[model samples]
Target: MTDERLIADLHNRWVFGWERNAGDDPFDFRRVFGEFYDFDSPDVRLYDDFDPEQRVATTAAGYGSIWEPGFREMISAHHVVDDGPHVVADLGLAASTLVFVARITLPDATTDIRTTSSLVWRRTPDGWRIVREHNSTKVLPAGALDHRLPARRIT
Candidate 1:
């Protein structure tokens, strides 16, 4: 298959697997990490705008640990933004950028967060492994809380 299609599948599966677990909260780390992470890289980074101190994660385990069994599980709804996932790749590198909106239900309140993330992957012996990712999030306005997405699924 073509590289573009392959990369898209990789991203889609990684995302769908994560979102699917929102029902139970705290998605399994090993499932997606094993398939999509470059465990040997020793410098996998997950940059975020909300916390400047957490801009980069330099270890494979450290990066994976960020999403492991955390408050992210309270996600009541999640959807990939339509017309997003602007993907590009060349040589042995690929990057997929997309906007995701999720609604989180806390103990007393529910809020919507929209995050735009760019995940960078490298083609390795283990196939496509994510090496780096950067994301920025903003609290959505109360009126913009629509969770609708296109009917067809990517994966």
Candidate 2:
């Protein structure tokens, strides 16, 4: 398969796993997070919903804290690659935009959040790994997420 296809496939797989995990009783944090990121690379960075302004250096282990347990989360995700997997020497670069609606069910109340993320992937010896990520999220006022778009879903 072509590099672009491979990268797209990888992105879809990760999204599927994320949705699957969200529905699981005991979410498998390591299975998805550990395999998807380049922990060995000291350059990995995250500018996610937690702190959008700060470009925090992150690792596979660090993700455990961010995805904490307590509330149950269910997400419907869509991924779109707007540009190329422009190969630069030994590195392959692909930029993707992901939109996901997460339903968080707590003991008292449930809230739905819509998040848009931009990710920069780097091809590594292991496979494609996320090198940089930025996310923006907002609480949905109403309505369920539309699943009509061509995207990966678990439920």
Could you say which candidate leads in TM-score?
1
Flag clash pairs in model 2.
none
Model 2: residue 2 alpha-carbon error in angstroms: 2.1
Which number leads on lDDT? 1
Model 2, 74-136: lDDT tens per residue?
Answer: 343333333332322234777666565665444344455666767678877887887877778
Kindly provide the TM-score of model 1 when superposed on the true structure, using C-alpha atoms: 0.77
The stretch of ten residues in a row with the least summed lDDT in candidate 2 is 80-89
Q: Write the per-residue lDDT of candidate 1 for residues 1-155, one digit (tens) a residue.
A: 87777887777666565454334745557655688888788667877674535646776677656655444644444556543667799989999987777655544455566888788999999799989988888987753665353222222
| Model 1 clashing residue pairs (backbone) | none
- How many angstroms is residue 81 displaced in model 1 relative to the true structure, after the best TM-score fit? 3.0
lDDT of each: 0.67, 0.57
